[model samples]
Target: MVERRPAGLRHSIKKQMAAVFSLLMMGTILLCWFINNFFLGEYYISKKQNAMFATYQILNMAATNGTLSTDSFDIEFQKNCGKYNINYILLDAESKTLKTSTPDYSTYSQRLLNNLFGENAEHQKLLETGEKYEIQIAEDDRTATEFLEMWGVLDNGNLFLFRSPLESIRESVKLANRFLGEVGIASAIISAVIVYLISRQITKPIEELTGISERMIHLDFDAKYTGKSRTEIAQLGQNINELSYTLEQTISELKSANNELQRDIERKNKIDEMRKEFLANVSHELKTPIALIQGYAEGLKEGISDDEESRNFYCEVIMDEAAKMNNMVKKLMTLNELEFGNEKVEMERFDIVALIRNYLQASELLCRQKEIEVIMEAKKPVYVWADEFMIEEVFGNYFSNALNHIAGKRVIDVKLNRHDNLVRVSVFNTGEQIPEDSLPHIWDKFYKVDKARTRAYGGSGVGLSIVKAVMEALNQKYGAVNYDNGVEFWFELESAGEKVDDEKGMETEESQNG
Candidate 1:
C-alpha cells in the first residue's frame, strides 16, 4: 500500500516569487544609491574644482599686475571668470577691497568681511610696503562661513584678506544640489526597472522547472518546460526538461515491470488452485479402482463366484482394477516426486538409438492391437546424457498417447539428429493437428485437449507436463512444432562429451535448489 503525503502550503510558488522580487529590488536600490552619492558626487566635485581653479587664475593676475586702473585688464579678468561662472575678489595688502565683480552683496557681507579680514583702517598700513597686492579664492558660502567663524579679525589695523562673493557660490551649490537630486531619482527608477526585468529573465526558467517538478510529483509524466533561447535560464530549462524525461522513462519502465510481476503472481495463484483440484480428481480416480478391487476380492472370499469360470471372471476383474489403480498411483507418484523435488535424476551418456529402438519394440505389441506401426529414422547412433528411467517414461507416455490418438494409417515415427554440441529428437504421429490456440499451453500440468479421449486412453494428462519438467530439470530445450497434418514434439539436449557430466550435475543441483 502507498501512503499519501499532505500538501505543504508554505512552500508555494508565490512565496518564492516574492522572495526573488524583494531581493532584486533591494539590490537595485543599493546600486542606485552608490552611483548617486559616490560616483556622481565625485564628478560634480571635480567640475567645481575646475571652476575654482579658473577663478584663482583671474584673481592672481589682477592682484599681481595692479591693473585695476585699466578698463581693458578689468574687462578681460571679468570675462575669463564669467566663462566658467567663477567669482573673484582682489584686495590691497591692508585687506581693503581693491576690486570686485559681484552684484548680490547684502549688508551681512560687510560684517562677514569685517570678521574675516580687518576694518578699512588696516588698509593704509599695507600700502606702505612695496608688496601691496593680495588675492583670495573661497570655495563657497559654507566653506567661507566655516573659515570666518574659526578666524576672528580685529581692528588692530595691521593685516587683512580678500573674500569672494558668498551669494554666487551659494547659487552654484544650490544648482549642483538640484542636479544631483534629479540624477538620483532617475538612476533609482531606471535601476529598479532594469533589475526587475533582469530578475524576471533569470527566474523564469526556475519557475518553469518548479512547475514541472510539482506536476511530476503528482504523477503527471508528460509535462515539459522547454526554454525559450540560449541563455543560462534556457540551459537550466533544457537540463530540467532532460531530467524530467529521464525520470518519466524510468518511472514508466518500473510501472511496466511491476504490472508484469503482478500478472505473473496472479497466474501462479490460479495454477496453484487448479493443481489442488487436479489432486482431488486424481484421488477420486484412484479410489474408484481401489473400491472395485476390494469389492471383487470380497465376493471371491464369500464364495459368490461358485463356478470356475465365474471365479476366473471375478479374479480377472480384481486384477484389472488393481492394475488400473497401480498405473494411476505410479503416474501420481511420478508427478508428485518431480514437483516436490524428491526425484533425483542420475544422468549418464547412453546411446539414444538403442533407447528408442527398445521403446519401439516394447510398444510394438500394444500398437499391433490398434493396427498401428512404430517406425524409427536415424542417420547414426546419437549419444545424450539423460536419466534412463525418466527419458524412458517420457517416450513411453508419448508412444502411448500416439497409439490412442493416431488415425488413418495409425503410425508413430521417431527421428533423431545431432548438430554442433546438441542433439534433437522428435516424435511424430499421424493424428489431428493440435489446435493453434492450445499449442502454447500443451505443457501445463493436467491440461487435456480432448477430455473424453484422454479418459478413454487412461491418460493422466501429466505426460507433456512431465516431459517439459524433465527437459527443464536437465537444462535441455523442448517444444511442440505443429504441422498441417500432425504435431511433432521435439527436445534438444547437449551432446554427450567430456564436459557433459560436469554440466549436467550443475544443472541438476540448480533445478533441485529451485
Candidate 2:
C-alpha cells in the first residue's frame, strides 16, 4: 500500500519555485511600466524645458543686438545646438513664418502653433504681450510619423524658436525599456535558483526524518535520524529521533498490555456465559434436595410423638436454606440484567412524603423485630421526579439495612427536603462506626463494610449494588454521609419547583401534577 504524506508537505520545491517566479515577474513588469510611463516621462519633460530656455536666451540676445535675421546668427545657433536632438524655429508676432531642422512639418506645426500660441484672439493677444511662454502641443504634421503622433511646443518669442527632435526621446525610452527588461529577467532567474536551493537545504533533514518515520510504521525501529541542518530543522530531527525511541518503548509495553486485555475480555465473556448457565444449573441442583428436606421436615412435624420443638427447629433450618438460595438467584438475575444494559425505569413525579410513608409501613414489622423506630420528618407533599417502583426498592433496601444495623435504642431518621432543582432524601441511623478505609469501596459490587454483622442479619452484599444500579438508571444522585453518631445515606432526585396555595384550594392534585 502507498503511504500517505503528512499534511503541509504536499507542495514540492518545483511548485514553490514556479509560484515565486511568477510573482517576481509580475512585480517587475509593473515597476518597469510605472517608471517608463511616469518617472521617465517626467525626466523627458524637464529636458524639454531646459531646451526651451536655451532657445529663449538665443532669441533674446539677437533681439537686443538687432541681429534677429542674420545668416551668421542662424549658423551659430545651429552649430551650438548640434545633435541636441531638437527642432529650431523663429516666428514673427504674425506667426506667418517658420524655421526647422526636420521636414515632416504638418504634425509638428499643429503642436507647435497650439502650444506656443493660443487659439483665435487669445493667441494674438498673448503674442503681442508676453515675452516668453511654453505649452505642450499635439501635432499631425508630416514631420513625425509612427508611435502616438508628436510631442513638441510653440515658444512665445522668449528665445528664437528651438525644438528638440521627438525621435531622440522615443529612441531613448525604448532603450530604457529594453535595459530594464534585461535586468529584471536576470534578477528573476538568479532569485529562483537561489531560493530553490535554499528551500531544498532547509527541507533535507525533514525528508530524512520522514523516511525514518516510514520505516517505523513497518516496526523497523532501528533507523535513527542522521541528517544535520540549522537550529529549527535540527531540533525537528532530534524530536523525531526521540519520538522513535519512545514509540518503540510504547509498542513493547502495548504488546503485553494488549495481550492481557484480550485474555481478560475473553475470560469475562466466558464468565458471563457461565453465569447464565450456572443460574439454571444451580436451580436444578438445589431444587430436588430442598424439596426432599422440606418434605421430611413437614412429615416429622405431623408425627404423633410430642417433639414439637425438634420439628419446629428442622422446619426453620429448611426455610432458611431455601430463602438463602432464593436470594442468591434474585441477585444473580439483577446483576445480569444491569450488566447487559437492559434495565428500564418508568419515571414520574410523586410526593416524596407519601412514598416514604408507604415504605415505612411495609418495613415497620422488620424494624419492630429489631427494636428499631423509623422516624420520618418531612413536608407533606415534597415532590420529586423518579421511577417510583425503583426508588421504592432502593428505600426498602436502605430501611432494612438500617433496621439490621441500628444499635441501642435502634432509631432510624428519614428526612426529605428540597434543594434547588433537586429533592434530597437522607436516612440516618444510630450504628457501630463504619471503618474509614472501607467508605470509598462501599459502592462497589458485593462490597460489605461490616461483613460479620451484615451476614448475621442476612445481608446479601448485593442490596446496595442494586440500589446503585437503580439510582444510576434513573440518573439520580446517591451518596453516604458519615457523622459522629451514625452514617446517613442520601440521594437527590429532580424536584418539581411548584408551590401550592392551600388557602385558594390550588393544592388540588391536578394542579400539583401539572
Question: What lDDT, from 0 to 1, does candidate 2 have?
Answer: 0.66
Give the runs in model 2 whose Cα sits over 4 Å from its true position.
Answer: 1-306, 499-514
Cα-based lDDT at residue 281, candidate 2: 56
- At residue 36, candidate 1 shows an lDDT of 55
Tens-place lDDT per residue, model 2, 1-514, is 8877675567775557656775878697768867895678558756665665665567567767877668998797777667455565544566544565656554445555665444432222111123345333323245433212222223443223445545567678878877777777777777777777777776667677777877988878889977655587778778888988999999999998999999999889977886766565556545654786777676776783468787776777677767766885697578557655676777888887788887788777877777787776454576777888878878877777777777755779886655456766777788776788887787765577876776566666677878788888877889876677787787778877655333221122121110
* Clash tally, candidates in order: 0, 16
Clashing pairs in 1: none
- What lDDT score goes with residue 273 in model 1? 78
- Model 2 lDDT, residue 2, Cα: 82
TM-scores, each model vs. reference: 0.46, 0.43
